[model samples]
Target chain A: MSNKLLECVPNFSEGRNKEVIERIVDPFRKTEGVKLLDYSADKDHNRLVVTVIGDPEGLKKSVLEAMAVAVKEIDMNNHKGEHPRMGAVDVVPFIPVRNVTMEEAVELAKEVARQAAEKFNLPVYLYEDAATSPDRQNLASIRKGQFEGFKEKIKKPEWKPDFGPAEVHPTAGVTAVGARMPLVAFNVNLGTDNIEIADAIARKVRYIGGGLRYCKAIGVDLKERGIVQISMNMTNYTKTSLYQAYELIKVEARRYGVNVVGSELIGILPAQALIDVAVYYLGVENFSEEQILENRLLWG
Target chain B: MSNKLLECVPNFSEGRNKEVIERIVDPFRKTEGVKLLDYSADKDHNRLVVTVIGDPEGLKKSVLEAMAVAVKEIDMNNHKGEHPRMGAVDVVPFIPVRNVTMEEAVELAKEVARQAAEKFNLPVYLYEDAATSPDRQNLASIRKGQFEGFKEKIKKPEWKPDFGPAEVHPTAGVTAVGARMPLVAFNVNLGTDNIEIADAIARKVRYIGGGLRYCKAIGVDLKERGIVQISMNMTNYTKTSLYQAYELIKVEARRYGVNVVGSELIGILPAQALIDVAVYYLGVENFSEEQILENRLLWG
Candidate 1:
């Protein structure tokens, strides 16, 4: 468990130009001790998302090198995007993946934030686990005023940047960096077209509605499929297993005389999350991670 | 999917002597491209079990090296164990863990069997998937005659080995080499202590009893816990999942008003077996091995 792994997902403003995107991603590829897991761009959002995992120092080094490219290549004033943006290198999140701790991740985020603000003269706000106050914990709140609105918003007394000068950069604008747990995007489709059932179950299973502590749920209507989905963000799957939420939804659906058609897991998730569900369903006792053959290949 | 990985488990005769056990295990450690996953010696059984995984050629080379050490250190003429044995190295099974096919594993098994028999001057029988006939398919049937009994048994026309001489070695007896699918040691325990319910369900659920295609089940009485268990070996988990067998047992138990009191997974199993169970219970569609973070670290 002392292997020390962290995932860094940094989003940049430019997405259409392949050369610029490659230029910004080249450092991550060239950096030692860092593996570029994936990278994708959306022309409409005009955003490029790069995912990489490595040791703390290595990840920090790569992100800084990549940030330099974004700063030199992108100017927020000339940027146009369908998605909200506040800076050339919009946001970066450091996730504690394996042996790394949240506190350590928070420290790593702060170090990157301070170094980035100093190097690029870009205002940085710490959000989520790395936030200085509760108000800064939500990334959306800090990024509420997009690139244009952030120019005037940065001057407010309570809206001061956590790192660098109070003023936004002349071109790059501002950015947000944070440390947070891995999120599991899970959706359970009910065998009915009643969106209200999905809505009610979503509210019942979400954290605010007194369900799982680390869950955030919403209802989605899959019009073409003729079914409703209870979408969820399992913020901490270790504490709140995906199966627990699925079973709870199934129980709730039974009351409404509906069956669960199927479920979907969006994006990526830690292998342990899936293993936990396997152990639960199979009722496996005395099972260890070492029992999993891939664990040896991954760690040893 | 093209990445070839196979598991080789070789059982040796000498377990009481620490020096001999270490000597037999040394080659697997020193060999490149091979990982010595586990090795345990049971003094009562006077047997040494070694588990290793690697590319086909690497695994074959390591096993042959270890077999030489085992053959040199232990004399079958003086060997005795609670478990049945007919050679210094009793049996070797080649299991396709990932990407590797059963046909490829069988070829590897045959190559090892021919080489081991020629070098060591020991008789080797093909068993399981590599069996030349249905009678030689079971390791037990081939090894039914113990070392003392095997001397005379080997000269019989029907008992001739697929490799090496028809007669046994002066010190090292005959051996069995096999290629088989990954087997799952799964047990589903019931709330009742009555052995009949467990036995009846076991009969209804096993392949021989018109149930799952690849299941072998038996009922065990747990006097201490006041429960019964349906112990099973899912010989081919791909065709017959652990969940399917467990669910069927639950349905059968319900007829007798018995409840399932959890279950136990014995020894090591391939990770795909666990993932298959997760996919079944969670109803997760479109989930790929690539989505598991460890898979990126493992194959990437």
Candidate 2:
């Protein structure tokens, strides 16, 4: 609660079983200092994503506790799911929320990795900011073989785990721990149901399409709502803001004789991203986040 | 900070002396749970306003400590200022910011008032929501005739102090303590420099002229910026939001062909006020404040 905030989103393998999910999520709910922001279990993906925020000490403790439950409940040998995951506790990413620096978050992730490997005898990959090597930085590259293929892939000289034995565990499998910036799930809905308008805007507003450098967007048709939405993941809000993508979509839609009906923020987002919108739209000059009342309390 | 949040803005007389001002504000900064959100001194008005937020216990302790300092340093008999005053420590307002209700805030104000009356032997009047009588609810009515007049005014039956001795303190004078909703100091700058357009729009957008219920607006000329401004105090953002005021001002400005050049928020404001702007402009339906990352932590 006293500044130095860190956000941990740990993805566990068990999602379908009601009792198992509860057991895995118990530590996060019961932890004193940790604030469980969100937790969801998708039956189709058979994956659980738990979002929690707290100081370094409390967050790390809660994460390891949840990891232990996931290890005990999920047996990778018999586990089957559509999502590509390499372990029972698939990916644990520590994001710097407030006063915490990315380097500090990386150190925290490494600490968790070091602890998990010894306590559970599970192979851990330090991906992203905590990655030992350049190739290990991408979670997908490290998780290329999945749990089954990783059993043999671990024997490769280049594919050695960062912690624990050079071999995979019997039940728990492998997990990725790292640090990364906060991602914003922002979507802009178009006036017309025609998805073509959405696709056109998405191309003009995404990184690969030579638009905003930090955006990854795709057109989605909300069939029930009778609109087309440019569902987006703002990978780096600081670099390419929500307003940047939103305004571009508005501009692109105008060419097609379409209006942006509305926009949506799908999941949780950092408060600064939202405040930036107000500052931009209102043309409030030299406005600092310090002026936000709640922020002063949390800044600690 | 754990859900039961309260905002206290304590205004004290004597703004010219920086040494005395710091002494008054030091307790709020030193207290553990209390957060010093903002503090400003107006030389002309000769007043010091300190905005702090904390839990009930911590907030109460800081306010009382500051009151003692004001009592020791300031003597109303020799005090002279342009602004209205009835005490060394003039007014203390408790506001519900996050999860705390208005009723709970009123209770907190009462506790502070009772303690101030006992410790400092100062006459205390509860205004706004904490007022025992309807007449006392309005601070101005209770503060009639200023410090020089309140001595004789207190002899009347209707003017009996809510707490403390029936008479005011020999040096400290009398103060008002109460609870109320958070106010937003919002100002919209017009493209034109003409003061008439700003005045006309202000009349159309304020409550007295049949506009938004919770808005009080005035026209101002920002000579340095060469723009006329519609300065406003949105007394209740929940009922009359920033976007509502901004949008209405835009619509009204159309008649005079003056674009809203910019807007500014003076001092501190609740985070929800800014979030509400994004929700309205973006057309985000069914969005909850709980979804804000920083808020999730502060919600406790």
Candidate 3:
């Protein structure tokens, strides 16, 4: 087997302060095995999302070091953003990229959660695939009242923390560590500026509305461009391919006489996801990732 | 910039002898920074094709070691094969994979060719992009007379070896070394077993027949499977993408009323080649390889 690669997208609560964000991301940059793919700070959301991929052990160590920096430099009590959060180091989701199983990711998540809780005296909750109970599986459920209400909410038996003290950390608050599949942020732009058409199509093409099994979508107005967009989070590309969502959107848009102008991939995504879409569009048979020379060099 | 990567596909004369094939392939397997992507031996063709990619220096060293092994074990005088050949080590093509230009590949090829000829007392002829003259640009032209005729062919001033003695190596014969674009071996199978229909489509989809500029194709009968195939070598995917070839074949097949049953990729191909096909078929706007997570992780 080749190297086990795990993608970790860690969100932090202090995006407005450049120094704090840089400090928190330092370990990831310096870590030997860890590759820092991308990092961005949203001023409106006041959140920093850092994308990284590396071996489980190296990733665990690097995340721990970054978490320590976050605990030291960020104060969640003073944090304010458009996005919801419950801690200085808000959430860390481990995604299995290559040569790694979901079970292994869950195990790694729990291990990192335990280490962080013990090392920093900070409260940690296991969510998503690493959740101890079904009720905690959804991240929003655990972060219901955000940082302010977490202190009181954590004391409840049903809402007890997975690790460390039940009470929230005085300044850092609490963090959620979990394992999940890679999420693809895909968006389709329609020729018409009518937001209603995009909204109608998005409703019929998402999982919540009985469409694709693992797709979550919302319609947004691209005011500057005079067009509407069907933004989507493809939670599981294996079950709900990019092409399926694209074709569905095209079909639905045609109902309202709207043509798809183009599409956008918001961030980094697994190469296999796009390869699958290529196979579908090209009607290729017996296609394998091994046939791609670069993948073979990296994985072989 | 990331490390420069070059792909080398070397064809050896002895494929029937497992021991000799293994000996020739061992250096590539053990060399550092040189990844042995694939190695296959065809009994009928009596040839061994080894695909590898790595840093220039490391790859050159490994190739030389393998060539030495091939020179010692394989004798062209006693060689018998269905595939055309003129040496123990028939041909070595250097392809620029990533961060490496064609000029650099040509230089590397010339360097390796000179080294091999000097060290082995073997005659080496540069072909393809590294050809000393336009007449030697095609491997088939340089290998016209085969091993037995090379002794006299080399005597001609126009056919003098690029390096070493003008005469062939009595036992090993002459080797061809050069640089060229990555060659993609793509085959599209048709539903019907009508070789004429396949041949007609192949003629209309190949460069020689005024079809795609970078394509070379021929019709082949898959007798056992009861189908005819258009076997192709896409010499430059950047200029003539896989989709362009596939689409052209589809258009030509329509003339003969034959349906495409399936397609096959014979060996490893650059990921960019497939990505181009996906972008064209999906009609995606502003798609960049940086958006692919694995590419970013590996090359960013």
Highest TM-score model number: 1
Model no. 2, DockQ: 0.61
Report how large a share of the reference interface contacts model 3 reproduces: 0.75
Provide per-model DockQ scores: 0.73, 0.61, 0.69
lDDT of the candidates, in the order given:
0.90, 0.89, 0.91
- By the DockQ metric, which is better: model 1 or model 3? 1
Name the weakest run of 10 consecutive residues (lDDT summed) in model 3 chain A: A276-285
Off by over 4 Å in 3: A155-157
Q: Among all windows of ten consecutive residues in candidate 1 chain B, which has the lowest summed lDDT?
A: B291-300
Q: In model 2, which runs have C-alpha deviations exceeding 4 angstroms?
A: A17-23, A26-34, A57-65, A114-121, A130-138, A141-145, A151-168, B16-36, B41-44, B57-65, B107-124, B131-144, B149-170
- True lDDT of residue A173, candidate 2: 90
Per-model TM values vs. the true structure: 0.96, 0.88, 0.95
lDDT of 2 by residue, B24-105 (tens): 9999999978888788999999999998888888899999999999999999998888999999999999998867899999
Candidate 3: pairs in clash: none
User: What C-alpha lDDT does candidate 2 achieve relative to the native structure?
Assistant: 0.89
Residue clash pairs of candidate 2: none
The number of residue pairs in model 3 that clash at the backbone is: 0
